[model samples]
Target: MWERQDFVLLLDLDAFAPKDRVDAFHLALNDTSVPNDVVHESPEKGIRARFETWRVGSLDLFDVRSTGFEVRRTARHVRRHRERPVVSVSLQTMGVHRAENAGERYVLGPDDIAIFHELTPRLYGWSGEAASWAVTIDMEDLGVPVDTVTRASVRLRTSPVHDLVLAHLRTLRRDPGGLEKDPGAAALGTATTDLVRALLTSAAHDAEDRRVRAVMNDSLTQRIMAYTRCHLTDPELSPDRIAHAHAISRRRLYAVLGRAGIRLEQWVISERLEAACRLLTSPRHAGLPVSAVAARCGFTSPSHFTRRFRAAYGVTPREWRRHRIQESSRTPPDGPPDTIPPTA
Candidate 1:
């Protein structure tokens, strides 16, 4: 629901009263996904910080031009985390900036793109007034592993594909309203996602045959797993059915799964079990019967579901649900939940 809503936020320190500028800037940055502390270095020049953000489709397009300031994410901050995972692609358009992550440092200049994982402890700063345009990629929408995305980030480099992505971003920024109003906005958005995925994939590739095959297989596995997840309730979700849907031979599909050290049937069963567990633990489905839960997760019979559930989890379905309820009651309201629902 939030994704469908279109909004924009623009903040300029110069527009605010001298007394309110610092507070306003701090509040504004706090509202963003990449929250950070802002410090004014030169008291005489004041701080020249301006930020504009547009939420278009799955991407958060950010245009930031700030005076010399430092943004730091400390280990303490990581412990009290509030933000979800996001990959920031910084396109340096003006002055240079330095980024430090895991003891590695990178200096980026104009036309150079650097990627950073927001959840990773890092520090970035620039001297004088540095200008840059950043595109924030939602971790969930990247269709790849967070580790893979992180590996492709925070590097100082230039490429033809990077130039193309920058061009598309410039067009999107110039006429955001027009693009949003167009009928092909969704398609264009998808194109941008694919472009970003391609950029990352290309950057992380190697010349070795084994490495290339591994990369291709990993991407294929992610796509197949995503498809299976969406169609988990389908009773006919067999390896043959998946192969047909993806236009790949069944043998090839088996080989792909084999490379990932998983069997097709095992993957499907695990996804179904995860879905059933999720429904059983959810308050919304509290009144749903065990048979209903089993049927919803593609099980043909309640007894079969119970047997498999107990075998995999070392507990019966009812016992598992009771345990989850008790645990939830004792845990803090804002505490993190267990990593269930199984992502591939």
Candidate 2:
């Protein structure tokens, strides 16, 4: 039987008759998403399983606890779910979980996280009493290319962000009710997306196959831009630090960005200048001095900041602020004000 409470859904085999448990479980899973073949290790002893699911924004979270069972998704199943692809990140909480996908076998113990794609054929099972929590994210929402995901799937632990992401997932597992009731669940979902992107980007960079790495360089360029934007206020942010952070050589980093036509230092300078412009026009920072705004946006010197700001926006910071203020007074109360365009 399936139970629904608000946004959460639960299916407990105990609620079903002994003869109907397996079929009910299969049907429930098939109804939710893709189809899979489920086989209990000891049907005579009866199946004891519970599945609970809830949504955190665009990500769907699942908690599955069972005695022992095997679930297999064949090529036929992949074909059925081809149009709607998803990546699942599963964290084993109790007992051992084993998976075979893409001609590779993976074993995960308690606290281990495994990432797999639903578009691929897979075999997953547990031998004894096992419990796991997983989150399903649409590949489109995940923002990583499928090839990069497939390559990073096997090298997740290599990323420096892996442990941080693992901790975050653990926290999500700890508070289902709080997540459901929280108004900021959407923001948390966005943060999860960013963390997962960072993890996969870093992991994919560690791949040994140079051909695959080269193929993923374009995705890596985007990750680098995102990482740089987040660390714009850090004075220590540099190509060496960025390269080390992503576990790639500095030369490789330059080459990747070069192929993408992104001048690293110039891009960083433009981003900082853009940030300064936003602060200059912001009402909250209305009282902040031009030099203070520059410092806050990662410019080391006031004169250097002024030169770059004028070069990028054709106006000094003070002039930009004065112009915005004047424009704001003339605009209708409900109308949108013009924004400074980003530097190229």
Off by over 4 Å in 1: 1-7, 154-163, 205-344
lDDT of 2: 0.77
* TM agreement with the true structure for every prediction: 0.54, 0.59
Please report the candidate that would top lDDT against the real structure: 2
How far out, in Å, is residue 114 in model 1? 1.9
**Candidate 2 runs further than 4 Å off:** 1-7, 207-344
**Count of clashing pairs, candidate 1:** 1
Clashes of each: 1, 0
Query: Per-residue lDDT of 129-248 in model 2, one digit per residue for the tens?
Result: 898889988888877787677777877888766776777787667555446556868866776776777777778885565643553453466556656776887878899999987789
Tens digits of lDDT, candidate 1, 1-344 = 01121336578888987777778777777677556766666646677788877656666778778778777877666565554577777677778888887568888876566777666778787888888777777766666565555566643232224555555555455445445555656655665666666556655554344543444444565456555666778877788888886579999989887986878787788878877887787766778888899999998879988999998899999998888867766766566443232211
